[model samples]
Target: MARGLVGFREQAENQAKFFVSRGIPIYASVLTTALEMIAAGEGHVPSVLEEAWKDREFSSPYERALLLCASMRFEALRDSSHPLAEKIGDDADGQGRVTREELDRAIDFGRTLDSLVRRFVQTNEVSRSITWQLAATCFEGDGPIVVIDLGTSAGATLVGDRIAQNWQAADGSPIVLGEEKRARKRYGLDRRPVDLADSDQEGWLRACIWPGQRDRVLRFRRAVEEVKKAKAAGELVVSKMGAEDMVAFVRQIANENPGARILVAETAFIDYLPPDIRAPFEKDLGDFISAHPGRAVWSGLEDALAPVTEGGGKRFPAEIRLRRASRMHVVARCEWHPSVVAIDHAELAKARTPH
Candidate 1:
């Protein structure tokens, strides 16, 4: 909860544990380790994390750490060099400890991180589009579809079905795939739209990812090229829009193509919304579907939205809900980079989620 909600000190500790639990490289733990060191109030490490801990300008403490690390990483590259050129090409594991130089650089960089955190810290976890594929399974229309990703970054996941995916269970058994292949029109709505063609902006997105996951990094790069190809084809476009306008956007599209089905989705989007605004935003799509039936469905993939047990691990389900049908079902619980999955086809077929 600290990851989504708040608790600066506890958020730091839990986020560190989360990275370790996710099998993220040991190098990523530097965020927590430095905070612990800074608690001493004096030394080579500057005590700057304290100021941002309780601040309410941004989302969670975990995001604060991401912003801090990303800002610092880029700040180190002011000398006209790729920040991750070596890390991307190298296959070596990050050693199990944070270095003194890392601490020194982080300290120097921390002073400038607050402004960036407030302005430019958002994740475009394109891999989370597995949920979009699952959600697409909800509407059975074959007359093409509309997919609007609210947390769109470079709109990578907008081309999900086009991307090769391997879905499996904990024991590595293949799961039955859904019919979420291809979309007629895909529009990504985001407050800050990223242009993958821009190296500097793209580098910042790369920096947000935790270190030492070479496979994830490679997959993202490939996805970037795919998105570029998609842009050329004009099948996908990311609009500079906010989630607040999602209802109106869908309505506008529906007016354009009354026969086409629409799926409004959010992957880890609610975590960044202010507390007062979360409730209205959470149910806006659902309410929209209720008011105007059959054309639109809501799909939400967030950590705290729905939790279920699968593959002997705590997992968050990519849930699909249809108001008119009074049915809802979870397609799967997608883990990191989500080349793997755990889905119950029987449950999905039965629409186990009660309306």
Candidate 2:
């Protein structure tokens, strides 16, 4: 419990700091107060989080707690007339502190504590730019590209590959991919996939967005809309399955499409797996890639601290890796949400060594 509380505090404070730096003062204030309340064991917050604190299901207690807070705020903001909707704003004086009564009200607003725990972070669009970059570098093959998205909540990331998006590199150059190189085939797997066409699911996706990031909210909504349109036209498919199952399915697809280049991508999903499962998953991935030498690539944009025995013990805030034909490359070390990316050419040159 003590470790959980300490971890939760650190995560919350980090989230608060990020929001503050991003100009969302309202979120920063709410998260800061939430952290304080959790530390003091005040209000119903501690009781609400008690089970999660004890459970080892969460890889990051901070993320679990912070997402709960965001969920509450999302629920509160859904009703335009809600007190919090008017209080949270970009204006300096408009960022009001979250009151105990308001917190209680949010708790009573229908979503159970356990339900919030089960909710996955669906911010896959954040990694779209980086995924494109990886595809360009790792998948320099002739055949059509097939992207299999693991832990694909709402399938926004899968859909993102099909649509046109503007992204800037670290040096502010525009990043682009030709239509031919884009994933002609897209498949997504999730324990529970959110249907973008459903109003309730759409609302939940909206709720998942941070309170004040209008650009992100808009971007997410647009992605959802595009996916819905694509699905209706019979251009995409997202299946309900776990990560391990998704890998098996990818192998089957590879068998069917002999020469098609496969790119298995996961962003922010691998961190949720337990240590026991995570290691096996990586091994399974390596074995699968080894089975089909030059036809496949496994790309990941995950926490830099993920336990990798190789790579010389250097730590980064976040790391992007592309593995193809027994060779692994540490492509970039970037911000958690890599809206801007810095490519390490020197590291890229050295990454060709067999892992």
Candidate 3:
């Protein structure tokens, strides 16, 4: 349902605050002003922005707003001549606050990029590969594993073992966990799979990230190289399947390999799910977990699902966890992406306890 002008402003503000907290002030300034202009009757705001709020496919006005924000970044990145490019440059000014004129330019730029907002936010965050790998280390000795990813996007995460995890402690020292290669087979499902080989598809993922964050872009690039290796290995083919179908496919895999452990994972993918679909998928997957008991594990590297406090009594914005049925053990707290994770030895030790 579309939030009217009033409701749109509120949600946009909330999302803007989140952007600021996440250290993307350029986005924070642009998006808040863009939606504010739409809410009030100022400037020639794009009608498609309003249309998306009404469209059921887009669950939130905040999401649509960011899509528009990212589209501007994409446009700028593609063509330096674009009006929005000046604000999204890789220099210090790009990371700073947006001026009123710059914000206006972004609103004007929205008309050209309005249609892009309808597309889902398909980040397929690359650093989350490390998070999944960290969680898998907990059960490394259990048995051979068949890794399945729901909403796998480009299937970059299926190659977690291939990702270089330069892990860090809360005190900022390196903590090596050695190499991992336990997964015998890996599979992934995405509603619309992105072919990393395709430049256009790859460009979109690059644009989804805030410009000037070179570390994140570098991590994504590295992961893309790893995903190529996985693709060459097998049908780590990111099948075009919805969440429910992905669940069913996972079950089929589980039945086929009774001897192997089922490691089902979601990497920042839960927030993409609308409430109605997420509910049913949870019920179906929960049923699978309940039936399998010790055999099946559902791990999630999610911001919304992270515990409030980790093993060390420190709080984090996001966490990696291992879940079986209703029980959960948070394996680590991520201070930042692509690197800097605080593995909680206390909770990791608890993973050994039988449920």
Query: Can you list the residue pairs that collide in candidate 3?
Result: none
What lDDT, from 0 to 1, does candidate 3 have? 0.70
Kindly list the per-residue Cα lDDT of model 1 for residues 120-227, writing each as its tens digit: 664566556776777666566476778878878778777656655565675788654543644777888887899888887776676666566665566677778878
The candidate that wins on lDDT is 3
lDDT of 2 at 63: 63
Q: lDDT per residue, candidate 3, 19-48, as tens digits? A: 887777788887766766666656555454
Clashes of 1: 0
Q: After superposition, how far is residue 316 of candidate 2 from its true place, in Å?
A: 6.1
TM-score of 1: 0.79
- In terms of lDDT, model 1 sits at 0.61
lDDT score for residue 37 of model 2: 70
> Global CA lDDT of candidate 2, please?
0.65
Q: Tens-digit lDDT track for model 2 on 9-119? A: 677778777767656677677777766677677787666766645553556545665566556655565665454656542212324467766665555555646446566
| Candidate 3, residue 87: how far the Cα is off, in Å | 2.7
Give all candidates' CA lDDT scores.
Answer: 0.61, 0.65, 0.70
